[model samples]
Target: MSVAELRPNMDFWQERVDMAAAFRWTERLNMHEGVANHFSLAVNDDGTQFLMNPNQMHFRRIKASDLLFLDANNPKTLEGPDAPDPTAWGLHGSIHRRCPHARCVMHVHSTHATVLAALADSTLPPIDQNTATFYNRYVVDNQFGGLAFEEEGERCASMMSDPKVKTMIMGNHGVLVIGSSVADTFNRLYYFERAAETYIRALQTGQPLRVLSDEIAEKTAQELEDYPEQDVRHLNELKAILDEEGSNYAS
Candidate 1:
C-alpha cells in the first residue's frame, strides 16, 4: 500500500499489524521458543502504556487484535482474567513504563543468544562485521534472579535505560533488544542472533579470536546506525510474504 493509503486514524491498526508480523516472522525464523518469550511495543509517547502478547499464546498464532494493552503502573494486571504473563508484565511492562526511548522491546531465548547469555562472559566480542554492529552499544546485566517477577523485572528494566545501548544480554537468562520502533527492534533481534551464532562458532574453533580494534568497531557500529531506515524495508518485505501466505496475524 502507498503512504497515501494509510489513513491517519489507522496508525494504531498499522502498528498492531506490524507488531503481529514481527511475531510471525520471528516464529518463522525459529527464534520463538514455544510460548515462552515476549515482545511488546509502546502505544503512547510516555511508554507507560503498551501492547503485549497474551499469556501462553504462541508467537506463530498471534493476531494483531490479540495483543493486550497494559499500563506499567497498574498492579491489577496480575490478577485479572486477561492478565499478561507475570514475567512479561514485569520485564516488558517495567521497561516500557520507565524507559521512554525503549518504545519496542523484543525478548527471546533464541539458541545462540541464550548460549552466549549462559556464558560467564556474555559480551559479544567484535570478531566480525555482525559483531561490530553491536560493539560498544550493548550492555550486560549479569544479575539473574530467575523469573522476572515484579521487582526482578524492574531491575532488568533499569539495566536497559541507556538509550545508547540497544541490546542487553541478560546474564544466565536470554537477550533483550529495544528500539524506537517495532521494525527496528525486530531487525536488531534478527541480526543479533546471527551475530551470536557466528561468535559461538568462532569460539568453538578453539583458535584465538581476531578481535577488531576499538576505533574500527566504533566506526562500523556508527555505519550500521546510519542505515536504520533499511529495517522498514525489511519489515515491509516480510509483511508482503505474509500477505501472500494467507497469514491470520492481522485478523
Candidate 2:
C-alpha cells in the first residue's frame, strides 16, 4: 500500500503506538545505538508531517505519547521545546518531504550491517535467499559526511527518491530501510541485518563464497517481493508481547 492509501480516517494515535513498539523491539534486539539512530512515520495524508523520537531518549524507554510531531517543511521546528535530534529531523524530514512512497523509514547502525558498510565492497552479495531479497533493490551512499544535517539529509533523500530503491547502505555508516508502513519497514530492517550477518560470517571463513547467479538472485528477489502480508502479522505478534510484558510503549 501507498502513503496516500494509509490516510483517510486513519488513527494517527495508533501509528504512534506502532512506531513506539518498533523502537522498543529494536532495543530488545540490540539494534539501538544509545540515543542515536532514528525512525519516522509520515502522519499526514500527503506525507509531509511525521512523528519522530525526541532527542537523547533511549528507544527502550520511549512511549507512544513521547513522539514529537513536526512538519517536514517547517524550519522553525528545530526552535521548539520538543525539537528532535538534528540528524533525525534532517534525514527523516527530507525523506518524508521528497519521497512520498517512503511513509515509514528505519535507520540504524546494527553491528553486522555496519561491519559490511565499512568494507571496500559494501554491496550485499547474494549468497543465499535472504541476501537475494535486496538483489537490485538497494542504493549505496558511498559518501559519508560527518553527521546527517539537512544538506546530507537532502542528498540521502534524493538517493531514496528513486522509486526502485528500498534500502540504502550508507558507506562508513549503516543501513536505512524504507517502506509504506512501519511493519514492512521494520521487517525489512530486521532481515537486512540478518542478511548482512550471513554475508559477514561467510567472509570470515577463509574459503571463497559461492555467490548466487544474477538470474537466480533476481528471481528470488521478485518472489520475495510478491510474498504476502506477513509484516503486518509480525508487528501484531510484537505488540502482543509488549501487551503481555508491559504496556509502557502504548502510553
Candidate 3:
C-alpha cells in the first residue's frame, strides 16, 4: 500500500501497542497516579521525533492509536493538535534532545519507588538478589528544585551520562528508567519497583535485614549481563496476565 493509503509503519504501530500495554500493566501494579506519569520512545534513528501518550489521558484509557507522534525539534510542538503534558514535554523533550542514547524513556511515581525517592539518601540497597540488577547501575540526582522545568530536562540529561545505568531516581520526583526499546524499559521498571518494594517492606518490619555482600552482588550483576532477553520474557509474562484477565491494551 502507498504511504497515503496504508497506515504508519509496523515499527510505529508496534511502539504504540507495546507502550499502551505497558501503561495498562503499570496501572494494575498500582504504579499509575490517575493521569500523571509518561513514557516515550524515539520513532526513528534521529531523536527529533518520538511517541508518547497525549495529555490528560489516563493509563487505563490509553490505546495504541491514542499516542501522539511528537516532534521534539519542532518549533510549534507545544501548540500541536495532540500536545503533550507540560511535564512530559519538559522532561521527555529535553532528554530526547540531549541524550541520544535513550531510545525509550519511562517516568513514573510508583508507591515504593516514589517513597524511596523521597528519602534523604536515594540509593537502592543491595539487600537481595533482585536489587542486585541495579548494583552500581543508578544515578541519584540530589538537586530537586521544584517541577521539572524546560531547563531541567537538560540537567537530567547531563546526569544520565552512563548508558549502562538504566535507572535514575529523579530526586524528590520519582523514578526514570530508559532502555533501547519500550519492552526493555518496562521490564527494568517492573523489577526496579519490586526491588524497592522489598527493601521498603523490610524497613517496615523493623527487623535486622540480610544485606548481600559486595562481592556476591557484583558477581550476580555480572551474571545478569548474560540475560539479554530477560525483559522480553518478563513482558511476555505480563501480557499473558493481561490476556487471562481480558485486558485488550494490545488490541
Candidate 4:
C-alpha cells in the first residue's frame, strides 16, 4: 500500500511534519554534515520519550513518516532494527533524559559554528543584533571528548542544566541548541550560525569590531525572546515555500 496507508494513525503528525521541514531547510542552507547531525523532539511528559531522525539519513531526504520513536529510559533502544546513530542516541538521548526543559534538541557541525568551536575561547560575543540575540544565553563546553558516547553525552548534558542557556558551543566540536519546540530550536540554530558567520567574517576583516554594550545586548535578547511567534512564523513560511515547490518533506 501507500506510505500513509502503512501508518494510518501516525502520532504527533504535525510535530513530525514540522521537524521534517526543519531538516529539509537545514540541508538547503548547508547546515547539515554528511549524514551526521541529528534533531530530536520530546513527545511525552518528563521529556524521556522522544522522536529522532533515523540513522545515517540525509536531512534533505527525510520525510515525516521516517522519524524514529525512542525512549531515553529504555536500555534496548540501540538494539532495535530502527536504532538511531550511536552519537545521536548518546547526545540527544542524554539531553532528553536529564534536561526536561529541553523539549527539542538539535545538533549540527555547521561550518561557521564549528569554526567558532575550534577557537580557543569558543564564545559568541554580542557584535550585532543577531549576535546579541544569544548574549548571556549560551554555554561554552570546553571539554571535547572523542566521540559522543554515553559518557561524553552525559558530560555534555550536564552543561545544559541551566534553563537560561539554550545554546552550547561545543569546543573543538560543533553546536547544540535546545528549545521548547521544533520551531524554537531550529530558529535559534539558524540565527546562531548566521551570527557565527558574521563574527567570523568580521575577524577576517582584521578591522576593529564594534561590539554591542552589555546592557543593550541583554535588552535586545529580552526583546527577541518576548517577540511573539517569530519562530513559529519562520518555520511556517518555510513550510509554505516547500509546499509550493511540491517538496515531499511532509509526506
Runs in model 1 lying further than 4 Å from the true structure: 1-11
lDDT of each: 0.90, 0.90, 0.84, 0.95
- Residues 69-91, candidate 4: write the lDDT tens digits: 99999999999888999999999
Best by lDDT: 4
What is the Cα-based TM-score of model 1? 0.95
Better of 1 and 3 by TM-score: 1
Estimate the TM-score of every prediction.
0.95, 0.94, 0.91, 0.97
lDDT of 4 at 237: 99
Which candidate order results from sorting by TM-score in descending order?
4, 1, 2, 3
- Cα miss at 139, model 3 (Å)? 0.6
Pairs in steric clash, model 4: none
lDDT of 3 by residue, 178-229 (tens): 8888888998898899999998998899998888888988888778756778
Name the weakest run of 10 consecutive residues (lDDT summed) in model 3: 1-10
| Per-residue accuracy of model 1 over 80-106 as CA lDDT, tens digit each | 999999889888888887899999999
Off by over 4 Å in 4: 1-7
Root-mean-square deviation per candidate: 2.2, 4.1, 2.8, 2.2
> Using TM-score as the measure, which candidate wins?
4
Query: Which residue runs does candidate 2 get wrong by more than 4 Å?
Result: 1-11
